[model samples]
Target: MCRIAGIFDPVAENLQQRIEGMRDAMHRGGPDSAGVFVHPQLPLALGHRRLSLIDLSEAGHQPMIDAELTIIFNGEIYNYLELRSTLKHYGHEFRTESDTEVILKAYRQWGVDAFEYFNGMFALALWDERNQQLILARDHAGIKPLYYSTDGKRLYFASEIRAFAHAGKVFEENSKWRSAFLTFGHLPEPITTLKDVVPLQKGTALIIDLPSLHIKEHRFFEWTFNGKLKQEDEAIALMRETLEQAVERHLVSDAPIGLFLSGGIDSSLLTLIASHTRKDNLHTLSIVFTEEAFSEEKYQKLIIEKTGAKHQSFLVTKAIFNQQLDDAMQAMDQPTLDGINTYFISMYAKAYGLKAVLSGLGADELFGGYPSFQQQKKMKLVEKMPESLLRGLQRMPDHRLRKLSYVGLQNSAAEYLSYRGIFTPVSVAALLETTEKEVEDDLQELSAYYPVQGLKNGNRISWLETNFYMQNQLLKDSDFMSMWHGLEIRVPFLDKEVMLMAAAMDPAIKFKKVPPKYPLVKAFENELPEAIWKRKKQGFTFPFEGWLKENEYIRPSNNAEQKLYQQFQQKKLSWGRYWCALLMNRFTPLP
Candidate 1:
């Protein structure tokens, strides 16, 4: 919803210019207004770029400061109204009817303990003058991103990694992260393409003590699948209720809101619920492709007819892709194989004058809607194989079948890698000019960061999908791409309360029915149109393979990239692999 940047040091001079540069780099994120706050005693400056979603007045402006604390926040607190009421009863006062103010008051009422009380996506930094320390925190689900770097002299933090360069931080290309990106199609969290720059972990808070410069981190939340089981009927009812509440809470915005309907169960269900909450002026946005195989216009129409909501559609063709591809690529602040879909969709939403929209992003990970869920069962058969044989198989030729071999030899993270990875360790080594052993070592380090601890089967797969894929790729991509167009894309399924409810669900209930997403489809079966819920699940995608042929700006140069590109031209390369190569070449060209 906004862009925030700050620099903290006890003796840095010309701090305002540095903060302003970071703020200007994120100008697209918040074109409505800009503000900069310089701390009186502490050598700190906070810069903000505002899009004006909530209050639409000067009161909602930031870097908002009171007597005790000054804060720069980038997110929405859905439960702010409720928290504000509670804080008022506790004798807290407010000047603006904005969630930004609510966060300040909440922090006043309780210290860092206030993060657990919030149930929305956020990445924020609050300078606590009273405590003589600075506190930075991210939302529980990592829906928003915060990037930071330090040189033992000054600490710089921003909403996007690109802003760091404008803030005068030089970073050499990181080979390990390049290898990781080539392997996974995106870099995992807490790692960036630049050396020494890091993403603050999700569900965690970072505190920097002012003069001493000591930093301590606290993990405020982590998603787990182990929860008390409930009866089938009871679980379904609770999921429905929780989802409805999450949708309603997301509807709390001052500007007009819309839905990105993919004509799938998740978006349709959200539209159905949102229709009940806001009957009029509920716009739904969709994209139809000239390649009919990639179009969901038919199902989009079905949902439109059922909800009777105002509809807008973008007809994407080769010309559209050609015209928009370059700009979209330039708009990317980070290198990613995905998010081109999000970038185009958010562009259309902004052109339609909608400030905020709801997207059904996290539904697949939470409800077992991906093939990885079913594949996890088959992957378990690997446990019967001998460890010596499995280790030998790791040296096998890198191919689709060979990757599947690795999936069986290990656990959920390995299975997820086989299913979701873009390149094998050998392939990444070749591409990044690194050794296969180094790539393997980087992957091993990445696996250690994976949240899949002791979860089993479907739950383990869910953990990997949510933590590895959703957290690293989907959520980060959604944030930068959408925010690039100054649009706020809200994900109700990623709501902390909703995620908690889903985590408590028995894995047995997740895909018990056909088309997967068993609990969601069953809970709303009567309400959802049969034509919509009964169809085979289709991913939200555009016709990229055809367009890639015509786009010359994405060509590869060196032997490594050229090799991958040649395979793509021969149609032997997977789209994921082609995309990975194209983006890497486009963004971080090989020197």
Candidate 2:
């Protein structure tokens, strides 16, 4: 994990200072090294901050150049060794064993087609001096972030939004900012707090022509649930094999690695697999709460005892939450209601001197770990009613009936918002002092951005969870929060090979062979400890229910937040709703 930034203005001023300032703004992501590349004749510059995961030598330094090609990269090319071999066979020699160099040669050898061959997480910018072109690309899963803003003929791209401040960029609030955040509890991709900046979509690249400054987008990989149907057992067997291969690929780090052992079925399965494969003892980490109800220490211990992995536990208390809140807030590149737990875990990992850790983040999204899968099936009874009758139930007292009100149309946004939305359009408008129609319009616009037209039933739900929830929120938050602590949170579940295989399976067998995660459990049920899977699944939890209400700094700052906080204290709203309400107060742009 690293940070990248660059400027593409022909009449650029103070290029050196601006690029370096932008890079340094994100220094926490990559404190190991920093560099800037500027073309002598062209109005282009690239900046990079290196975390040094792959190669621990000067050869790993980025702003890496070969012949007429210059590049700045952030994230690991996990399959660089395999790609390097292929490149060498094709008569492409390399001076360094670094992934950055491998990428440079790969891009040189295959042109834009090389991106399709890459198997790991990455956000990169390549400058072709001869062709007078620049290519900006993000990984298939959006595990790493790359944001860009365009003003007339100029372009500014960076790994973090805070970097834009260093370049003296003006920040305008996106029209959808308040509405989307309130509805989703997180900002969806291609949309940020800033009006001008948007994420380069996952699995897509922007090819910019330097001469005219025109841009053309190229999509190298897009996941579709269109694989040939397989038997339940066959799919499970292939899934296990694919996951093992993915984990082995993820473990191919020059630096030491560990797992964020959540003690859930997904993480426990990975732990068991890693234990069987590796000779050395595994390293695992988790947060333990004094409040036993919220702590998974028992299950975590079971995994530790089974694998004999070296484990570290951070005992969290209210005092620690109060002490860490402000700094963690700074780590939030974009205001998010989730990912606070990830930030704290990353901080503990960094203090323990670990550079990288594995997480089972995408396992739930890929393997139907959410109630939405079952809920979708039940909603068909409600779906039988007329559209007008459904809309009449929008104001119902029961949450399920209210969610059913959103199902009149074939809409991904409606389905996702029904399950995970933070606020209704009316509430968002009231909070932001805007019209409800405007908020409704903004929500409608999201459907076009994440259209899962071909998918159906559980497959459709999986697509929405993976692309909308995981892509826009979980992955983005995990990247900023962990990388800000200089810890690379590697997700084996989200790997290209693993995700595609999971996406291909039929929903009948893919979802709920057990309560939470079936494929992962079926893959390793024998070796994995029973306590890990037998226990009731507690989705991402923190002691925030008590901690946030007690903390002075996290309290209400505005009228809307005050009302939300009062409801929070009354036990009417979950900690997550109150948390997002808190951030809206902090991050909302002024008129």
Candidate 3:
């Protein structure tokens, strides 16, 4: 829960100005304190902004060093104490009780292998002074962020992209990235909106040798769903045990902690476990929507009664929504269509005097909890058709039946892309001032790089939904939104141990035809209320349609929305068009 930045140059004389500027940009992330470590002989500097979570003492101050290594780290190492004990037995000495020191010492003993031994979310950079090498690494699932750029002579790294702006690196507004943004409502990872910078892929590490200026990226871990347990009962028991341990580990903070209870099964389970583990009465925060279709207050009330935890709820009115929307949009150092909910909720937790909040973000991806996962059987029927026939089907008129036929004809990635896309390729091309060929080219490029495997027609949809949709979009939104408020959001479901176990379970067991996330619901059947178990999954959704329709300040004037609304009023276009227009306007920057 901190911000880290650094500069490495072969020719530059000093890095003091660059380090200070980067630290200043990340002040919001860590308002407690700041530190900088500059290599005495080399033109290298590492900077840190402290959030003061675990150790409140100045001893925890970082750019932490052990004999020959210096480190600038962001994120919690939950297993630090255990790792510390292990290292101490090997004759490693520690000057501070901070996890930062633990990381330094562990690396001293284990080298890059230290990453595998770690069991927490992190994005860290360590400089081995003796070796004259810098090691940069991110956690397996990417709970934290790390961005970097290199010009063959100099390398720069930061926790946030805005830090680069302060480092005097001008970001060119990449129209190619903008094109992808217009289609997907997000600029997918490995590629940021900026042309010069790239996010280090999750589960990967980079080692830069200072003398040679050679950089090598290595994969440390990958999520796999192949390791199934022998027995169903054993799987359930193991899941419960692993989750409780993760909850306990994540609770290791000096500040007050709370749970972001959505009243959904995932959040409810977290609340239940945390209430037992935490000595203090657990504080639960929830958001209720003003829109009837979107509100989940009734469900929240049920959980509050069942758990009897001290509960606080906010009713998000149109006025509050409008204000937050504008603030959130402007908060976008990178554009995102999601995370407005996360931003406001984190803001609420901060106002309530909580520094860390637990969320159940990765459960849907880990377990089979999306509608697309259940639609696997339907997709298999389409895979049986010949390629030529399917190509012919896609050119049919844009009617409801024709749309379904077109969907049936698409390849695995294309079908999954359609599911996650805010606008169809046809619609995006028509709306954009650019040529259709360009948009199609971008889509094809994205499709080729889309990171899902096991592309059999049926379960391949599930694979794509988890890897591409959840990884690139949902998780990215959660990280930025929560960090924006200086609040540390720990997702218990994303704990490595929990994820490995969940991945091992068969899809049939996870998502039965009767109810989605069936195994999870069954495991907690007695613990949860009947209403909660029976209720349909109401995802975290904003009332974008209603908001656009009623907004008076920013009325549509001969624009896409206005034209679409006119068609709706004239009984030509349906409500779906209005929804599409609103999404298009939100994602596409106005002239």
Shift in Å, residue 86, candidate 1: 0.4
| Poorest stretch of ten by lDDT in candidate 1 | 404-413
How high is each candidate's TM-score?
A: 0.96, 0.96, 0.91
Error of 3 at 364 (Å): 0.8
Put down candidate 2 lDDT per residue, 4-115, tens digits, no spaces.
Answer: 9999877778888889989999999998999999888777889999998888899888888888999999988888999999999999888887889988988888899999
Tens digits of lDDT, candidate 1, 430-459:
777778777666666766576466777778
Off by over 4 Å in 2: 392-401, 588-591
lDDT of candidates 1 onward, in order: 0.83, 0.83, 0.74
- Where model 3 places Cα greater than 4 Å from the true spot, the runs are 11-14, 384-412, 447-451, 455-462, 552-591
Q: In order, how many clashes per candidate?
A: 0, 0, 0
Alpha-carbon shift of residue 433 in model 3 (angstroms): 3.7
Better of 2 and 3 by TM-score: 2
